[model samples]
Target: MRRPYFDLIATGAKTIEVRVGYAKICKVAVGDSLRFTSSDGSLFTRITAVKEYKSFDEMLDAEDNTGIGEAGMTRDQLLAACRDIYPPEKEALGVFALHLAPLPE
Candidate 1:
């Protein structure tokens, strides 16, 4: 996650962790506990839900911009950002919508 997105998650403003890397994230299942670290700090989160998509665009449509909006990004910005990280060819590999919540402190 980027700093802004990480901050959003830390502040509970964002709930879904979107990943463009399908292979690694696909192995993560619901109920899995994951740790995230950022400049803000580290926190433990439990995966509440996991949805797979055929492409980032598909995931974006399914998410309805809620996650991207939370990160202060518009749909086009989000798409361009994702493309910057992972090329459009890789986008077809799919995406993971990992719904997350903070674990008990």
Candidate 2:
């Protein structure tokens, strides 16, 4: 994860982790736990839900931008950022919205 996104997730401001639907990621179940690591540290979160969409635009329409981006980021910026990370080839596979919640301390 990028530092900004990771920080947002760490602070409980971001709750949705977006990724391209790779085969391995598709295998992750709702109850699975994920560990996100940054230079600073690592945080644990549980997958609350898994949603699939044809494109990032479609996923953005259904998911909250606030949960996927930094404070005050516009939907267009969020969409562009997602696209920048995952190219057309990857997006063609699918988009995955992994709803996340922090594990207990």
Candidate 3:
């Protein structure tokens, strides 16, 4: 099977003894633009901002679990694709936050 759009990898944090990747809006780097596509083939673009995590451990946890990519979709691209496929999922979260599915690599 191919890997998903994004792969969340967890590495040990200095403060915490364990390693993990937790899902947070801040995972995406600041200044980067994310383009998402809807199920009906609509496109939406937004710039990512800096999102802070309570602790390094929490950040690691989200990264460790996040994964998406396949059929030529990067993590961001996959998210865009998923946005199109599942618009309603993110409607409640706000216009910016999207429930993107990880693409398979």
State the C-alpha lDDT per candidate: 0.79, 0.92, 0.32
TM-score winner between candidates 1 and 2:
2
Query: Per-residue lDDT tens digits of candidate 2, residues 1-105?
Result: 789989998999999999988998889989999999998789999999999999999999999888998889999999999988999999998999999999975
Choose 1 or 2, whichever is better by lDDT: 2
Model 2 CA lDDT for position 15: 95
Q: Rank candidates, lDDT, best first.
A: 2, 1, 3
RMSD of each: 2.0, 1.0, 15.7
Residue-by-residue lDDT tens digits, candidate 1, 1-105: 578777877788888887765577869999999888886578889999998888878888888576553656888887777777788777767777889888975
Candidate 2 clashing pairs, residues 3+ apart or interchain: none
lDDT of 3: 0.32
Q: What's model 3's lDDT at 76?
A: 57
Please report the candidate that would top TM-score against the real structure.
2
Query: Which ten residues in a row are the worst by lDDT in model 3?
Result: 9-18
